[model samples]
Target: MDALIATVKDNDLVVAFALVGLVMGVAILISKFLTRGKFQASAIAIILGLVLAYVGGVATGGEDGLADISLFSGIGLMGGGMLINLAIVATGFGASFDEMKKSGLGGIIALVLGVVLSFVIGAVIAWFFGYRDPIDLTTIGAGTATYIVGPVTGAALGAGSGVIALSVGAGLVKSVLTMVVTPFVAKYIGLNNPRSAIVFGGLLGTTSGVTAGLAATDKRLVPYGAMTSTFYTGLGLLMAPSVLFFAVKALVG
Candidate 1:
């Protein structure tokens, strides 16, 4: 037992992989049992992962959550932008390029609409919450677009840390909602092909949410939806702290 423990410790990355797989398997089983296939396994796993991260943070008093534990150091790398982006690219290669050609302008429209709508919604919420600063409103609004964009916009705009955290939380809620709701709405929204997938991805813009939701809807659509969804982040990063902030400022101030 000691030898095996030492071996796992020596190869912490392998342990991280194993732990993630194990947690995912458990999450899948729980999803299947609880929802009877109504809810998505990946969505359940994401929620479970978040809960565990919270618990880990409370237990360790560390800001990085689960990654703060020495044994889970590998999670930081596994979940980093590099690996996540690599996965997105890999999945994108599985997409049909011909269908992508079909989506061209519509996909661009969706991206624009998605970022605008999400940012507006977030900014509105911030306003209702009594946050009057342009920086705070923009940061939180950008967060509604996506968590990554939230912090980036906040840092660029010099927003305080508390506002940035709120922005991240807003993005997380949107991601979870997208993941949980997509499959139920897939048919009604005409999310049946690559073109719709691209539009859907653009509208939601959270890569994990759009990808996982599309995966549950149709595995083939994951790449299509995620392709536009991936661009959503970059576009959001560009728009949030600049044009969106100025617009919100003009409206409120």
Candidate 2:
């Protein structure tokens, strides 16, 4: 038993991947049977992962969640930025530029509106919560566009770690909300075809959430939505520090 445990620990990253696959499989099964696919498998898997992370944190009283456990330590590396970026790149490779061009002016409008609206909403929420500093507000606002944007903006602006953490949390909530709401609103929002999916992706701007949501709505639309959402993320990253931050600073500082 001791020898087996040591071997598992040594192959921690591989084990982490296996565990994630297992979770996704279970979540897919649940989506197919229990929810009839109304609740997306990705969303369910995300919820399950969060639950596991919470449980791991509670059990070990550690900040790294499941990674704090010696056996699951590889999860920290597996879920790190390198792998996440790789996944994004891989997804981008599947998208067609011609399809993106079809979205045209509508896509551009969606992207601009999405960033501005999300940032305002996030900044307002931060202000209501007593976060008066422009830097903190900008960081959290950037997070509303996407989790990746939040940290990037926060780091560039020299915001505190706590503010950066809050930004990430806000972005996660938006992602989950997007995943849960997309399917239900798909019909009303005209999210049926590729052009609309591209626009929808820009409007939401969270790659995982947009991709998973579109997957639940229509698997064919996933790539289209993901492509625009990727662009939206880049736009948010670019604007958050220079444009958005400056506007906030001018207003509050």
TM-score against native, each model: 0.85, 0.78
- The local distance difference test score of each candidate is 0.86, 0.86
Q: Candidate 1: where are CA atoms >4 Å away?
A: 27-47, 63-65
User: What tens-digit string does per-residue lDDT give for candidate 2 at 1-253?
Assistant: 9999988988999999999999999999999999997777876776677678778999999877788888988888987768866765676665777877878788889988999889999999999999999999999999988888999999999999999999999998998778777877899988888899988988999887887688667777887787678788889988999989999999999
Cα TM-score of candidate 1: 0.85
RMSD of each: 2.6, 3.3
Query: For all candidates, what are the clash counts?
Result: 0, 0
Tens digits of per-residue lDDT, candidate 1, 1-253, equal 9897778668878887988999899978987898897777776776677777787899899867688887787887787779977886787775778889989899999999999999999999888989898889999999999999999999999999999999999998898688767877998999998898999999999998888777767778888988788889999999998889899889986
- As a whole number from 0 to 100, the lDDT of residue 84 in candidate 1 is 77
What TM value does model 2 have? Answer: 0.78
